[model samples]
Target: MSISSSGFSWPLRVYYEDTDVSGVVYHANYLKFFERARTEWLRSLGYSQESLRHEVEVAFTVSRVEVAFRSPARLDDQLIATVAVTELKRASLVMTQQLRLGDIDGRLLAEAEVKVVSVDAASFKPCALPDGFRNRVQTVENAASRNPSSSAA
Candidate 1:
């Protein structure tokens, strides 16, 4: 299994469409926000699910998602979504994710534990991660080792 990364963060801003009638972000909208962060995290590594499918004929799918609501995020609030690997198998990965409020001292907003499985595009069956994919993700681990917080400190 791959070890935990110190953590990766993606900045976001809560928009009007993301909220409910009460002005707080709907519970489920966080999932979309989280997904975007993860996807961007992968993009930062120079890979994308779409490219992974078109170029490598493989894609990642959410096998399971477990969310824990810790706090509310309101419209216009800047937030940060985090992604960190907790475990990795040949064909699946477990990630510990969190959403934190920005501008107010990095407060915890919500958290989730998500598991993803890689599958072949043609057959939609589980598949081992291609060498490139594994290597790219491993880059995150190495960077975390060098700078866990993604800061020069």
Candidate 2:
């Protein structure tokens, strides 16, 4: 994992199960990779999705996503998925994620802009994020701002 002014990056290796018969990554699998990166980003901020639901009665659900595939990644390829918060609203967050080859200067494979809403665990109704969670997000946002080179996808 690597953290930059741009966002949180999680390393991934394309596996056999992640590929198609031709060994190219299946299109839908990119969503799974991006989702994992987002979850890990939340974990890095000292919050776990399961714990949030159990303790705070809150959970995040994807509300919208727009993805563009630039290239196909093959099985065994080293990859990095980066998640950056582009907007933080009371009940939702908009993020941009990029999947790239793990090289000196990563090669872009796919990019997506996703929106996720915080909702009541039981009711599944939109809800404002907890104060502490908001603060954590702000902290990361502030840090990213300090590193101007970190650009969103």
Candidate 3:
């Protein structure tokens, strides 16, 4: 995994389980890749879902997802999944995520806009995200704005 001013990136290999009989990745599996990238993005800022649930009683849930499949990835292919916060609100944040082949700047296989909400872990009611978490993401965005070269798709 790598962190940059643009966003958080996680490296992954396309396993047999992620692909179809034809060896191309399943459409639904793109969502899983995006989800993992977001989880790691949170971890990069020192927040884990487990810790958040235990300490703050909050967990993130995907409220909406819009995905565009540009190309196909085959089994055993190396990929990079990226997560960048595009918008933030009191209880929800929109992340722009992408799946690329081989490296961060490689061929774009898929891209998605995912809206995630902070919710009460047990009750599953919407809740505001912690100030620290919001601030950390904002800091990253600020840096990205200053250095546009590391832009994420």
| Per-prediction TM-score to the true structure, in the order listed | 0.93, 0.92, 0.90
Local distance difference test, per candidate? Answer: 0.86, 0.88, 0.85
Runs of candidate 1 exceeding 4 Å displacement: 151-153
Off by over 4 Å in 2: 1-5, 148-153
Worst 10 residues of 2 by lDDT: 1-10
User: Model 1 scores what on Cα lDDT?
Assistant: 0.86
**Model 3 clash pairs?**
none
Candidate 1 collision pairs: none
* Candidate 2 residue-wise lDDT, 27-125, digit = tens: 999999999999989988889999999999999999999999999999999999998888888888898899999978688999999999999999999
Task: Give lDDT tens digits, candidate 1, residues 1-153.
Answer: 667667678899999999999999999999998998889878877888889999999989999999999889999999989888788789987888889987768889899999999999999999998887787677776688577767111
Candidate 3 lDDT over 1-153, as tens digits, reads 122346678888999999998889999999999888888888877889999999989999999999999999999999999887778889988888889997555999999988999999999999998888888888877787678665443
* Per-structure clash totals for the candidates: 0, 0, 0
Error of 2 at 24 (Å): 0.3
RMSD of each predicted structure: 2.0, 4.1, 4.1
Evaluate model 3: give its TM-score. Answer: 0.90
